[model samples]
Target: MISGLLLLVLVGSAMAQRDLSVDCGSDGWVTVHWRPGLGFSQTLDQSKALLGTCPPSSLMSEDTLLFRVLVRDCGFIQQVMEGRVTYSNMLIYARRPELPIITQLVKCDYDSPVGEESEFSAEEPDENREQETFNMEIMNPDFSGPAPSLRFGLGSSIPIRATVEPRSHRSLRIYMKSCEFATDADIRRATQVHPIIANAGCLMESKSGNSSFLPRRHSDEMRLYLEAFRFALGQKIFLHCDLEACVVRSLNVDRKACHYVPEKRRWTLLDEPSQSYACACCDSTCPRTGLMIDGVSVHKVLGPLVIVENEPESSGSPDSRASSAHGMSASRVWLLVFVVALALVTVMGVLVISYYLCFWRGGRLGYRPSRDLLTKY
Candidate 1:
């Protein structure tokens, strides 16, 4: 989904309707540029990207052959999508101020650096600090930005990346204590919760499926991707997570996320492989984190995400879903018509045979002229 959205934001290829061409096939940051507009149609392809006169700040050059440099980086509209930020603008090209010939869609996708403020937008960085220097939030699969209220297919995996920013407390390591899908964001009542990670940090579902913590890159960051599921059919779910920033001194039993490794025949610590013995209690009861450096347990809520029962069979577009549904409806109509036609043909054949036997052949319905025993005399 991220990749697909990025495609529109960053035009990967150059599409031209006529002499004038708009292209964003640059190396990085997606620099969309335009060539000289000469011998172009007066009424341009409305979809063609057009850049008007170059701004004073933009790099402008005047060639002897009556041409001017046109470029822009800012004036575009800023839009936020699923997880990433997109900058979009449509430029109208017209010699006459009142007339618009060509229209060009110019844009670029803002990707967050590996582990930096990827949570923040390209234009604005939202630190989103809570509970005294501690922070917890959901990041997109790319770890690019915040993922809020996104839609997911039921069977697909949601890369739930939860990270802790223990500002001055670098010695603290983050752990996934517990997580669940709840109908309500509050999740106060136990009846409303469908547990995903239980018993401190043990992935209870891992014994049967692929819900486990990913290997940690930094002590402050932890990612747990989940095979998407819902609390109810066609209902939205919220991820209610409890995270702990335990003071990291040495690797031990209680401070880790564990999942059952079927082949290894035991439970395993996500970050520490050799310390699988520490996760032995995952099958039953596991102790919680002992020392808290910040004395704050992060309760992160991410979603209102839609978990759909079936995804569109088409390659991958929302429009394809509607088209696929219409296709199915058409096929069913044709099938009904065929059945009705077949039934009609069978009835007609039966009627024709009955008439032949009763009137002409007279086999079963033969009426013999009995001897005039009484009536003729």
Candidate 2:
């Protein structure tokens, strides 16, 4: 009886050492250390961990816990190795009845964030009271994730939220506006909102949550009067943005340009503004010369070209008359050919049917009996 009691105490001591320890490293490495009996036990819970500060509450009937180690790096995590361990059931213990132990190593990768900063400036006219004033500020812009740094595509809208410091008694109104770029004979226009002024205060909160404003035509002349302030080209435009606002801010942008010919009355690239330039030549006039640049035309001399409609052609050259006649002749020729073909097909079909009936009598080329009956009568 005393020997049996000693055996029970030994078993109890073995059960008490059924714990595991694991060490994780930043270099995607994990090391595990455990006692042979409990670690190799096949009856352990595979999903439970028996190591570190929070160990599994209970072990398997065979004194083991199911534990797995995984590594994550470069946005990926994978299990390198796994297996079950067992004592005498799995391993032949020479003298010590300990289980066969196992350990695994793994490596993985995850993505890291990259940062950048930029600055921009612009000016405009005030919209509130119609004042020609401007404001400026320094902005440190940062972009993250999968966004491009320069030359954004069209249809891309960036959310903007900012706080302004006023320099005058008038409330600093923050807004956006449009600008115009014209050549000697062309007028290329674009619209964008610059900051405007309104009330003067330190913590001026501008809620840009639903403020989805985009550039429009004639926006160059009209500034986005944020109440009392305005921003235009050759004007001051900058701001100090709050951290919360910066995270959500984004920009929607598009660009287009086209070519212009003075002699041609056609205005091309009107639908595709990105590729076409703005022409200065009025629809009423042709042969008027002008300077074209960047899809915009600028007129050197202002004359009837600027006004007056329904101007008659002052010259009728032989090329112009011939071109008109050719267009008419082509239409006439096509119509005549279509009518003639239809008539010929109808006549040919009628003639073929008549000839077949007259030449080919009844079967076997023999005479019919209608005439014989008439002769007998």
List RMSD in Å for every model shown: 23.0, 28.6
Which residue pairs clash in candidate 1?
Answer: 48-103, 49-104, 50-104
Top candidate by TM-score: 1
What candidate 1 gets wrong by more than 4 Å, as runs, is: 1-135, 189-191, 288-295, 312-377
Off by over 4 Å in 2: 1-321, 361-377
- lDDT string for model 1 (1-377, tens) is 12212333222124344222333322323343343243445432222223322222232323101112221233333344455555444333333322222333445455422123312232432367434344555555555666533666666567677666655433557777788888877788534678888777788778766666778888777876677654565766688888877554334334567888778766777876754544655654543323212234768887677677676422233455678889999999999999999999999999999889877788645566778865787
